[model samples]
Target chain A: MTKENNKVTVSRRSVLKGAAATTGAALGAGALGGFPTIWAQNIKNVTLRQFGTGVSNLNDVATKVKEDLGFTLKMTALDSDSVAQRAATQPKSFDIADIEYWICKKVWGAGNLQAMDTSKIKNYDKIAGTFRSGKLTPESEIAQGTAPHTVGFVEGPGSKKFADNESGWMTLIPTIYNADTLGIRPDLIKRPITSWTELLNPEFKGKASILDIPSIGIMDAAMVVEAMGEITYGDKGNMTKEEIDKTIAIFIEAKKAGQFRAFWKTFDESINLMASGEVVIQSMWSPAITAVRSKGIPCVYQPLKEGYRSWGGGLGLSANLSGLELEAAYEYINWYLSGWVGGYLMRQGYYSAVPETSKKFMTEDEWGYWFEGKAAKGEIKTPTGKVLEKAGAVRDGGSFYERMGAVACWNSVMDENKHMVRKWNELIAA
Target chain B: MNNTISPEKTSWMLVSPLAFILGLFLVLPILIIIMVSFWDYNEYNFFPAFISENYDYLLTSKVTLDTYLKTFKFMILVWFFCTFIGFTVAYFLAFHVRTLPMQIALFLLCTIPFWTSNIIRMISWIPFLGRNGIANSTLISAGIIDQPLEWLLFSDFAVVLAFVHLFSLFMVVPVFNTMMRIDKSLIEAARDAGASGFQILTNVIIPLSKPGIMIGSIFVVTLVMGDFITVRFMSGGQSTSVGRVISNEIGLLQYPAAAASAVVLLITVLIMITIMMRFVDIRKEL
Candidate 1:
């Protein structure tokens, strides 16, 4: 029996070896310019568990990941809170996590995530310089020391150079980002809307909606309040208790007067609300606006005069990860920052961190349509190449630099977050 | 003594696995929740503490009372509709249908909706009840109304409709199980005693189906009271239940506050169940 078992095991190992060799040969002749030498180290059979959201094209990216990286990349998609829950309680269960930068401080404080070694990530230097500094444009810079990406870099022992505060590490690697503005049905609203205050305008009463999530939703309210000349916040991202109260009071009044048609919490809900004409205008993600337009609804992602409320998402290594698994993780992160994934995400209405890398993978027409804000040179397709735009359609908000450069607050987790949540609930309940 | 000891030991051995499972999965989690409810939490994270501020805040807040009252309002409304519908359906299946095969087939037909996802089934109401949905368009085209009915969806009416649609099945199964076991002779005897059809139903059928009604009520009340998703989506975020408040708190990482709210909800549900148990001893019938 033992001799027969040994024989079977040997045969299976040989079969796997043959399969690996054939795959390697295929990769050598394929589009990726063959397997890089660094991957030749026997990192096979290592499974890097990724706890993340499919906010980007991770599903499409997963199929190519195993073949390209020579290791299994298993991804488990979770909502933000559930991701935090798993990261805090079972840090060892995953090798890496993809999370929003707004929530990074809390997650890092919980000791679930660790800073990535920038030197190890080959495309780290390729990340847009604007992210490193808080500048949207040369002249219009976000106040110094307020850049979202700088929040997680701790300068301490065992750190690298240029790491502010404590070391040579980063909280997370910027993956996909975008500036968000409201999506509205241009055909329904007879007049033009230029300010965020229009969300609560009595004329659009019973036809406007906002997001139901508190952390993000309150910022939209703050913008409206600020635009209305109700009150100006010192820093909209991190509001104090009084700021939250004053903002929420406006929302409650609006809610009481039936200014909102609905408060949506999910992507599809917002799309359905706009597409069904249940709401004429609402705070929406860009993809959701595109989704509505694809369904033959006349929805436009309106560029408000007050600028866009931007949010960013990125990948972080787990605190417990090290050795071969860690190396494999580093490889995976580099692979993400490499041209393919970045290009894929950019095509899906997100701005990739390494713009140059993404540009290498995009067709000139695709680049013109997406980044240059020009009319499409041809029918624009998504990452999988299903047509998303006709030849004449111009992208909203113009070029990447123009759209992202507009000064506005990012999604935040404030010190008064608890009070904000309470007040926000009252607004919803009202 | 030896004989008694041996049988007792055998019985304990038989029950030990289940007891262990209940202790580990059920009892331990509740104990942890109760323990955590007294802890302290800030914006970033929660910490273990002996403070009762979480409970204090929950008990004193006006929002807590409003949420509980709203949840109870929904619970009572859904319970009324589900019980009325469930009992009537169960009655028809048990009494009106004479053949067993026909009864089984009809019962199976009632359960066909369960084969699909609950979330899908719940959201399907959107197209059916939306402003541009089938119901409104049909009404307009037929000249029944000038404008589409706004209250058909994303209203209190929609929330109740969704709860009834999702949880009516929970009401049906238990009531049907209890009804199937009710003796037919009781109804026949009541009729023979010169009782009218309504009289027979009241005097014999309903009395014997007490356990079923009680059981179904427990299922329905608990399901509606504990539900947050259906109310959230169906009401278009205008409504808040006790459970929704707990979820919102948990979303904000206010674990202590959430745990405290959950404990209150649990205690409230237990009290309701205890009162319901007085109506009929469900365990005896089962």
Candidate 2:
């Protein structure tokens, strides 16, 4: 296996060298009109390998890039955990690492990715203020936990440490994000559910679920615990060792009492649990709720009193990416934030970083329905043109501002992450 | 120069390819895991260092003991069901079936479900055993039970059910091979000596089938102990196994801890196999 990996690496290097020589010769023979045509021809040979979680590493986006930029965009979609593992461990395997903000906290220390220059990101000034200043509006209190802007910027291009405020250099160019909440099967429950505390209500015993991911799951647990009046954490995002212990203990007791039906780790599992009526209420992503509803089920991404636990994801260039490849990666990021890809992702219940740019690509009805909290003027459709909601249907949890503004916390990597993971394993074992 | 190679040299030559393959793939990987198990790790990276903390924590933690016990429970339960069902099926095929072609055809029929992916077969059980699934709906319609049985799915029962469904074939193939080789003359002699059919089965056939049973037991035991996905899926992430513990750690990028857990599991599995080997001389039987 090692021998084969080495051989592939060597052949790729030789290919890159050959491409560089050809580009150099083309430059040497350049004339004003012919140079632009030669450059376009050579760009067709460029292939940028990108990888991320299944949420946004899409084939449609790759196809669009191929059509518009005349370059190959090879995309690999892994689970969130695997995406982090690959980004931190295999620096040379990919050109772009599209990952979550919490994952950036983990991968940034490894220095596998180069800090992106904000000036080159055509729409950087137009990005959502939530990703730049950790607030929806200037008056909005920054949510607790690892908010995107905290780790989004660095001191300079060569810096590894995260800067306190926005610098010219960025760790990741913000792309897509969403405010997450509990999804409930209202037909089965037949009651008003409006709080995170509802997750642990014994009345819903054997019908409640949470994701099994340790870092994110712990934050969800903290929200439930705080709402239930069990413990008040200083920062739910960065829990102390004692805070972690108490939070896990509460969940373990609930588990023993059979309060949980199951803990899901993937998007489809959440949809399956809700669709099958196996789980009545659970912490769920926005898209999973949409998926359950699309299957003709009555599922709600319930707005809780305690607020949503939000996360953001973005594209980061690999440190190994340089020269033509680096320029192409920058071009891809600029295109991503420009309009079409943003609009495509926004249609799937996620908010694009540059909502203004996405608005241009979407119809007025689509914009009003998805982002302005208005009832659909007509039938709303997914990016694939499948009917999502009928006329008179409004998006769950209301408009983008209301949902993103009410975010109580962001998904975080705690200071005591190791202890939390160990305790989490114990919770599973128990 | 001598044109002919010596016997010992020829024997070494014959074994060299297999040795090289094992060394590169198996032995080297095991050695790396062992080395990594003793190293130190933080959140983002594992570094080379002589540290016992990973092992110390694993050996002393109550969770580790509980996970091991849970894994063992699964192993023993799955082993019992697989062995009993496997032996009965093999016995019927060997003694009751009259024609070789019929026996071969029946054996091939047993493998029909194996054509699809293992994950597909395991997941197919969800719709059958879920709250509103076929089993519960059927029970409700017949007035057999008013409420759905919650334990039918996402329980220890489901985990064991999937395991037995997936791995019984492993037991069937080996047991059937040995059952086919059992001497007919021995059964004839037992009958002539006034032994009943039950006595013939107990005295003549079972003793001869020990080797196959041992081999099958090994297969079932190791597979159950090493499995994480089946337990994770069938139990709906409500249950834990030794493999799951290691995998969870790996997911968190805690490699040294995961390696330590893996090393302990490997040792435990090895000890179990060694204990089983003592009950039967497998090489002589084969």
Candidate 3:
């Protein structure tokens, strides 16, 4: 194994050296008119393989990258769990990893990714405060759980340890995030649903669902338990063994009562559960709500009085990346934040990290409807040009500021994650 | 050197390829799983450490026993339905169908659903079994029910329904094979001895069909015992199976725990198959 690894290292070093020599020659050749000759020649050969959850690892993004950036951008989409597993265990298989903040907490310890220099980011200052300081506004209190800013930075370029405050080096370049809430069928329920406690309300018994992914599911359960005045957790993100026990206990009791109609693990499952009217209310993502709406259902991403459980995803460069390949990765990250991808994702109900840049790529009316929470001036369309909402329809959970500012917690990986997982299995068994 | 090879040596040469393939693909992987089952794991990575904690926890946990019992319940229910349905269908095809072409055509008709993906076939049930689905609406319109039956989907009933739907074919093919190969002389002989139709079926046909029944039972038992997706998808993630437990642990990156659960499940399945093997000598029957 050691010999094979050494041989691979030697071959990789030689490849990097050869690429560096070509880059030097290209730099000496310099800019021709306004366009660089490097993009037409050397950079076209650079294929960066990226993998992430199905939400963001889009075919359109890869197409747009080929069109605009002049490189082969290969993308593979997996579920969140598989993404984490691949990022940690098979780091050499990918050049870039688009992963969530909570997943970052798990994958970062593997040291498969190199820390990114924030100075290289063109739109660093324009990025949202939620990713930089765990705040949407100046007065915003940082919510519990693995908020993006907490694991957003490393101490230095080569450091494996996460810094408490922002350092120059970042673990992931902030790309897209959203404040998530439960999706409910407003037409079916025929009543105003509010509060996390509604997830356990007996009226919706056998007509409610929750996500089955243990880490994120536990946070949703924590939100419900706290809302029901059952337990006051010190920090929902970093729960103690006792807190984990209590939270699982509450959900198990509910499960015994047949409170949940189902538990979904994928985006489609949530959409189907709502559209079929099999489930009246459940934990859901922003895009899933849009998907249900696209099917002409009256699905609402209902905001509760408690607040939203938020999560953020970003791009991380592999540790093996170097030479021209590394430069192309940085360019890709810059282009990602530069507006087009941001605009595309935002239209799908996700918030762009560099919101100001994203605003440039969207129409005033589109921007107003999606981010400003204003009623649609006309028929609102998705990035694909499919009509999302008719005129006078308002975005659910209101404006970006209002929704993100009310974030009560973020998806987390607790210290007692193993214990929590075991208890979660027991909940399923029950 | 001998002019001709010995029969024993020729048999070994022929079997070596199969033995080598099984050792590489099947035995090696199982050995690796057993090794990994003893290793230790944390939140992110599993390291190479000889620790029995994974097995220790799995053996002691109440959830493991409950999950096993639940999996067994599903296996038993699915097996019973698949065997009964498969036997009836095969019996029909073997005895009642006069023409060989008609039997083949009808048998092929049963396989039309398998052409599409398993996931697609499984998911298609959602529209038919959902709360406001066809089954519910049809029942309501007929004045047979007032409210939609919630148990039609995302329930234990749905899980068993899907299992029987997907796997009865596994049972059918083998039973049909064995039944078709049975001699007509035995049935005629029983009828000549003044045996009634039911008596001939019980005394002659069933006795001859034991090998086929055993083969079908084994197929249904193994398939249902190891299923996770059917239980997860059909039951709407409410039900737990042994396979689901292993998969859940794997999803969390807990390889050791998953491997430990897998080892236990494999041993349980092997023991069940062994007990089943005692009922009939499959090799001799074949």
* Model 3 agreement with the true structure over A149-170: per-residue lDDT tens digits: 9999999988879998878799
* Candidate that beats the other on lDDT, 1 or 3, i.e. the better one: 3
Residues A169-204, model 1: lDDT tens digits:
787788888889988899999788889989998998
Per-residue CA lDDT of model 2 for A1-430, tens digit only, reads: 6685345434655666776777778778763355455556556667889999888988999999989997778899887778888988889899999999999999888889999888898888899999888878989999999999999999998787899888889999999999998999999999999889999999999999999999889989999999999999999999999999999999999999999999998888989999999999998988888788888899998999999999999999999998677888898999999999989988889999999999999989899988999999999988888888999999888999999999999999988888999899989988
- Looking at model 1, residue A108 earns an lDDT score of 67
> lDDT for each of the candidates?
0.81, 0.91, 0.90
Give the DockQ-based CAPRI class for model 2: medium
Rank list by lDDT? 2, 3, 1
Number of the top-ranking candidate, with lDDT as the measure: 2
Alpha-carbon shift of residue A173 in model 2 (angstroms) = 0.8
Clashing pairs in 1: A154-A166, A154-A167, A155-A165, A155-A166, A155-A167, A156-A166, A156-A167, A159-A168, A160-A168
lDDT of 2: 0.91
Which regions of candidate 3 fall more than 4 Å away from where they truly are?
A1-39, B1-12
lDDT (Cα, tens digit) per residue for candidate 3, span B249-281: 888899999999999999999999999999999
Clashes of each: 9, 0, 0
Chain B TM-score of predicted candidate 1 relative to the true chain B: 0.96
lDDT of 2 by residue, B53-135 (tens): 99999999999999999999999999999999999999899899999999999999999999999999999999999999999
Provide chain B's TM-score, model 3. 0.96
Output the lDDT of residue A332, model 3.
Answer: 98
